[model samples]
Target: MLTTAEILRKVRALEIKSKKLTTDLFTGEYHSAFKGRGMSFKEVREYSAGDDIRFIDWNVSARFGHPFSKVFEEERELTVMLLVDVSASSLFGTIIASKKDIATEIAAVIAFSAVNNHDKIGVIFYSDKIEKYIPPKKGKQHALFIVRELLSVQSGQKKTQLNTALRFFNNTTRQKSIAFILSDFIDTGYQDALRVAGNKHDIIGIKIYDKMDRTLPKLGLLRVEDAETGEQKWVDSESKLVRYEYEKDFFRITDYSNEVFRKAGCDLLHVRTDEDYVKILQRFFISRNK
Candidate 1:
């Protein structure tokens, strides 16, 4: 649990960092990646040398006796939802920051990015069940409120059941939204729910992980407890077979998650806790534009 003062202080720091990243790096990429509802006609203008012939207004051109183009602008009103996982597994970290910490930062950045683009932002915090739902709204205040909640929100349950969150999100939000799911994705059996959400909304997954999740250190025998289930087990990390199995399990989970997103027609990005998430996000946005 975080003290009120501590939460406020961290929220302030995150606000500054997220806003800076949004302005200096993400604004343009985010805008291009997640487009508006559709294009609306603005007016008609005289066609220029390079203007597309397809847009030529036949009536306007006939009346003016010259080629005229129908100008249109993107209707840039969009809703962005952050489906954040607050499961116990997210607390595990072996490097600079915990998975939860990185998820919060990235969520803040995404909120600011959406706000900058004049879009509404909302959040759905979840563990094994729906923890909280912040309705979508526009303005900096709403975005800031989301940042604060992301830092302070807690869940009663430690397990992760993504289907619960996705179903709740679908029920609450009727309009198609740009939804980002931030999680370590340590659970399974959510494929059907994910596919349903993907059909209705634009879904993207950001998988946050730690280095230790992929490879265990050779520290001889050690007792480890399951963060979610509270199950305890002893394992000899020094044994090659034990280390191999640990690594294999990690990859197996990764592969399942990858396949789920791929089959659902959604994009998924992996960010190690210690790696540069900014670069990964930038690349993703740029690739979407292409």
Candidate 2:
């Protein structure tokens, strides 16, 4: 467990980093990436060149005897939920930071970006079950509180039951939202839930992975532990067949994960532990914009 002071310190540092990313890098991209509910009428204005002809107010124009345009504002107060995986697998990382650590940073960045754009940000921390849920709200304080939870949440669960989190989100949030699922996605029985949630909300999948997960270095005998199951086994790393099987298993798991998002009509991003997440996010936003 993290102490109060430690939690506050981590929250403060994250606030600084999130603010920088929200302000400097993700200022406008986030807006374009996640759309608002709908457009609302602001006011009528005189028609100008390049204005969409579709928005011309014919009734007002007939009354005022001039071409007028209807200005509509995007109902941009969006609700963003972060469904984070706090399972044991997220604790496995051999590079710079663990999967959970990287998830915290990315979740903080997303929270800050939501608040920066005057949107409500919420979180659902889960590991086989719902560990914590922060209701959606707009404000810096709410976002900060979420960041604290993201950094300090401790769970006894060791497996990831993604369907539970998705079902909760689906039943709780009545209105449409931009939901982001951050996890290594090492689980099963979540396809129906994902499809149901994706039908009503704009869902995005962020796959967090470690480089070692894909490749195995031949160093004679090797011991591997499954974090979620708490099972350990020894394998002949030097054997060609063993290494080939490991690589094949990695590919099969990754492929299934990718297909889940694709079939759900959602965008997916793969971010390794050592890669630049900012560039990855920026490119994702740009692609959505196009």
Candidate 1 lDDT over residue span 1-290, tens digit each: 99999999998999999989998898689988977656779999999999999999999999989999999998688889999999899899988999999999999999999988889999999999999999999999998899989989887788998999999998999988999999999999999999999998999999999999999999989999999999999999999999999999999999999999999999999999999999999999999889
As for candidate 1, its clashing pairs are: none
- Model 2, span 130-240: residue lDDT tens: 999899999999999898888788889999999999999999999789999999987877888999999999999899999888888889898888988989999999998
State the lDDT at 134 in candidate 1: 93
Q: How close is candidate 1 to the true structure, as a TM-score?
A: 0.88
Clashes of each: 0, 0
The local distance difference test score of each candidate is 0.93, 0.91
Q: RMSDs, each prediction?
A: 3.9, 3.6
Candidate 1's error at 219, in angstroms? 0.6
RMSD of 1: 3.9
Provide the lowest-lDDT 10-residue window in model 1: 31-40
Candidate 1 regions exceeding 4 Å error are 36-73
lDDT score of model 2? Answer: 0.91
